[model samples]
Target: MDLIGALPRLAARRPPVLLVTMPGATRERLAVEAELTGRDWPSAPGPAAAAGLVVAGRAGGAQWLGDLWNGMPRPRAYVAVAHAGDAPHALDLLGRLLSSGREGDAPRAVSAGAPRGAPGQGGGDGPDHHPGAPGSGARETPGDEDGRSGRGGQEGRNGRGQARGQGRGQGQGRKQGRALGLGQGRGQEQGQEQEQGERGQEQERGQEQERGQERGQGQERGQGQGHGGHRGGVAGLPMAGRADDRDGLRLDRLHLPLGPALADWPAGLVLDVALQGDVLQSAEAHPWEAAPAGRYPFWGEPWLRAAGGEAVTRGAAERRRCASHLDSVGRFLAVSGWPRPAARARRLRDRLLQGAAAGELAPEVLRLTRGVARSRTLRWLTRGLGELPAGRARELGVTGPALAADGDVHARLRVWLGEIERSVHGMDDPRALTGVDGPRGRLDGPRPPSRLLLAALLPLLPGAEFACARLILASFDPDPDEFVGAGHG
Candidate 1:
């Protein structure tokens, strides 16, 4: 490689990998613990900082994924892992790609120039389609002689024009009096006045026609689309309505969608959020997909398989449970900004999945649980966030640790810890499993346990600050695969 080409490769000496989780692909835990340096986007400063993306799951769609791939700077690479066992191999390939220089291998979307500063490339939508970007608001309006819409800009222009017109009018009248010989020009002045009057009427007629055209277009757009047309606000969002805010100021509420690709967030889950400043005003939970086809819901696999009449050993179930709890803990820690502990939790999870014996893994689990649970700081930060009332939990169909913890994130952590401790002891059981006691909750019904948790979580986020809302969500750490019936965690 030339000096310019080799620079990117040299810069990638242990570059961070961006992990992209897909539905039913539970191999992300392995990738995160695979000794490969990993970084997250949107939260990782910018798109150009990472070496490559490690996608751990099936690649169903292309457009959104392409945009995400394109948004990265040149010399980027991507590798997909089909299963947990594939992570090491994918990481190895990623390392090779990064070391050798990814310039030639960059995705086609990048060479074509993809949208930047967009969330996951803002999907298949056109440029500036993402939230907070100037969208269709740039369209020229008939009423806008100065290329701006709304009353304020036009009024400002009109006011300035009127001032200029007044000055010009006074000057013209004096000039006409001087041209006709001051005192003898009364009739001439009258004639000039009549001409001026006619001209003013013509100008007014023209202005009225333009105004009428603008109104007609605006009306058509309102009938064809909504208030701001298909492309709304300055950012192309439907114009937000004003509501009383915390400081008693009327503020515009923005509906932002999070996830489906966010780091440490559930795969295939999208939360539509109504935000006022940094506070969540309202939120709704929806999934990008239901249970994915042809994969076991990774987190609840052992119990689910057992429910389906397959013989699953109690030891296997216990291992899954232990790993599942560890995964959740890792995500919670990551969201809490405790990356070191989060990495440790993921490492422990990977070891359990690798078939480590309970005797060997017990100490690490103890250290993690003890260190995390005893952290007065973590508890203080997370306590009382997203508290779910017991009655409401049942009403919303939430069970498991969320319900057990009285719906508080702090209490939920404790439940997870207790479950992990119990799971370690049961890891040696040799009997066949028959019930549906999965990590998230019972998997007896057609619905996934995470769905209930998601539903319950949406309602709780509305009034919380952004950071607290994220922490609260991380506490639940609902896995999408559990609902999809594909991939056991």
Candidate 2:
């Protein structure tokens, strides 16, 4: 065979080959290896010594060469074969490759000038019966196992090699003639196991491919059914509608959080709403569809859409209002008799500032929130609240709320939240705020009862500490429509 054309023939004693071919080429190379490469993805030995990279088309294994040398002590050579007869070019293309290895034949140790067993070839198969002989895998005869026997013998214990046929008189001669099948059978088992392992992996890969194809087919069928429904000219879903982002209307089969299932309605109707800090953040009144709006969904239709956040649509302003189970905070503020939720926040902020200056807040509170409220003064209020100057509140363990864990217990915050909520919602009047002064001159002015805007914040905070500390979130009217859009539609 032409050595260059027959690379595998040349590589029978070379390093393992790794065919880094793409999909189309992968199948091709696998078949080629069976007939040509004489290697496979698994049987390749180390990560380093894979034989040849049989790639597809062109530019196959070029990019992968550098990455191969990254952390390796001695990088293995690459043979990028996009087509046949590319082996010689691959060797030439690689500038540096490990040279053929030295130290193959073991040096014979001889006395001074005794005739050495030449350079190559073992002592003519005499001691070859030993396990480490040239033909190590080959078996020996039973007679060879006996110390008195030579490499070829018909007596004593049988090794693996067969002996010459002899007369039937001697038992050793007869035994040698009749070979035991022990060593020969073991060799066959090893080959069978390797074949079985390869077959197992191939079966696993086939199963994976089958599953993938099944999933793809299922997805296609579902898409086809949806397309057919739209083309049938439905009333709720428009045939021309794209995805929600591209089309004003979004049409897909989805559930309404609080309404009947879409499967009940031939034209799937859905509704969605989101709120933050007791105020509507955004509202979308359109369908997961857009063609021509249906004869305006009935006002009492439980799942009617609203302009939660959609752009102005034709006659959108005429749609009936949608009620959101949102803005619990705003509802509570309304319930609490706090006038004008939005306006009261400004007033509350001023009072907190006043309390800071008057030394009304506990000393630790000032330290935590105001960085010690630095000032050059020796006033009485400051002296009393900052230091223990025999004050009534100071005398009691309730030294205004504690700042540190030791000073103030978190459990107290829970109690305080309840008390504040009760006060805000009219469960208890603001007058019940024992040590606090009424609205006006004092910090935290006891405002004349009016609606307060706390993050449009509802007074019914969920967590105990939040109720106590008033951990209310704020609403930001990010878009101008938030105010003008009233989301009435």
Candidate 3:
């Protein structure tokens, strides 16, 4: 039985996939075939863990692609989708790649001579043990009474003990000398043991004294003392000024960057958040390089094309809108930690993308809406969260779900469900597309409404817990591609 001959059969087994999504790459959202083919999208899959790689959307920067390719495990398959609509084609290519196995483009095994483990560390055969480790044969030498084997203290003591025994043996009569030698040997051993005990005691006292001194120094340093008048930076990180926390106690500020590459987050939006405990103290958003030049934002494409006078059909536009709403709903559900409905929403979204007629889609959509809306736990979690007053929303020029929901995440979901229902009915209007209404907002404006949505959301995050803050942001589901196409960084 040749092991190499078995490789092809083993490779045919269903492969787990790691999705590396880039800006404008929403193809992974429509992966309905994943369930059918036994493909899994785990929360986090490393290169070695995933047997296949899917680069969704146009490939991103060269550095990112290179890193991903380098990290992929052997026996790996790769497929790329140039646009969100090309997911099905990419899946076909991926299937062929996987099925080919060792006969075609299977990944090469790692070189036997490849360098292993961290720098200066032994090869990856597991951890290296020190002299103090168990099974290391590190027992103290019999003569090392002072435990300072490196200082030659044990050698000197042994020499003196032998000399005392020998001198006593010479001074006494033959038989008496043998007995004296034995007695002196016993006495010398006792003396050495006593000295070793005293030495150990002294060493412990010295260590305690040193620790006391260090603690005093640490206390001085803790009193807002630092080299440049800043509280000693946390391990070289700059220390911002202190602020009053919710408990009225002043606390140091820590700035952390979340997302731009986070799980379930919109791609390319980085939030530089200042946090105290699990609470968001403040946040500033930095957008990534604008979406690739010239492509319409996927969620708003229909309205954008219509506004551009492309003579788009109303049914097509409505289909896009419903799909867009489902996309948002799926993401919201995922962030809320409810995967069942989120997956259902995504399946419906894919069905819509595959040209499912409204008559066929309406029942499931209604069922999903009813099931999600009936979740009392979800409502309790989202209630009163990120409240956007109507006047303020209008002042900020926000439209779409934000305006319709009057600004709470709970209300926003309600508005999304209502719009999805309306979209189903509007599918057969047969009218020529004229307006710029989209899932996010009107597309006739110079700037996408989502840009304003992110801005309006910043103020709502300060007092919220980090988890709630993430949910609030997910509820909005602002498209980062909008910012990129608008020339934002």
User: Best candidate per TM-score, number?
Assistant: 1
Whole-model lDDT values for every prediction: 0.60, 0.24, 0.59
Per residue, candidate 1 scores C-alpha lDDT tens digits across 206-260 of 5555544454454444334433222232212234556788778899875555555
lDDT of 3 by residue, 43-139 (tens): 3223334566565544433222333333344555655444444455555555556666533242211111323211111211123211112332221
Candidate number with the higher TM-score (1 or 2): 1
- Give the lowest summed-lDDT range of ten residues in model 3: 150-159
User: How many backbone clashes are present in model 1?
Assistant: 14
lDDT of 3 at 16: 62
Weakest lDDT window of 10 consecutive positions for candidate 1: 150-159
Ranking by lDDT: 1, 3, 2
How well does model 1 score by local distance difference test?
A: 0.60
In model 2, the runs with Cα more than 4 Å from the true position are 1-12, 35-42, 49-57, 60-65, 69-75, 84-489
Per-residue CA lDDT of model 2 for 1-489, tens digit only, reads 565434433444454433333222222232333333222222231223343322222221121122221211222333333333333333332212323222111211111122232221121122222111234321222222111111111121111111111111112221343322222333445445545666657666555555444544544443444345332112111123233322244434221111101101111112222222222222222221221122222211211122223333222221111010011222223222232431232223223322222234223222321221222221211121111122422223222112111211222222222322222223112121222211101112222111121111222222112112112211100111111111112
Q: With candidate 3 superimposed using the best TM-score fit, by how many Å does residue 4's alpha carbon deviate from the native?
A: 10
Judged by lDDT, which candidate is best?
A: 1
In model 3, the runs with Cα more than 4 Å from the true position are: 1-12, 27-51, 62-78, 83-244, 486-489
**Candidate 3, overall lDDT?**
0.59
Q: Which candidate would rank higher by lDDT, 2 or 3?
A: 3
Q: In model 2, which range of ten residues has the least summed lDDT?
A: 258-267
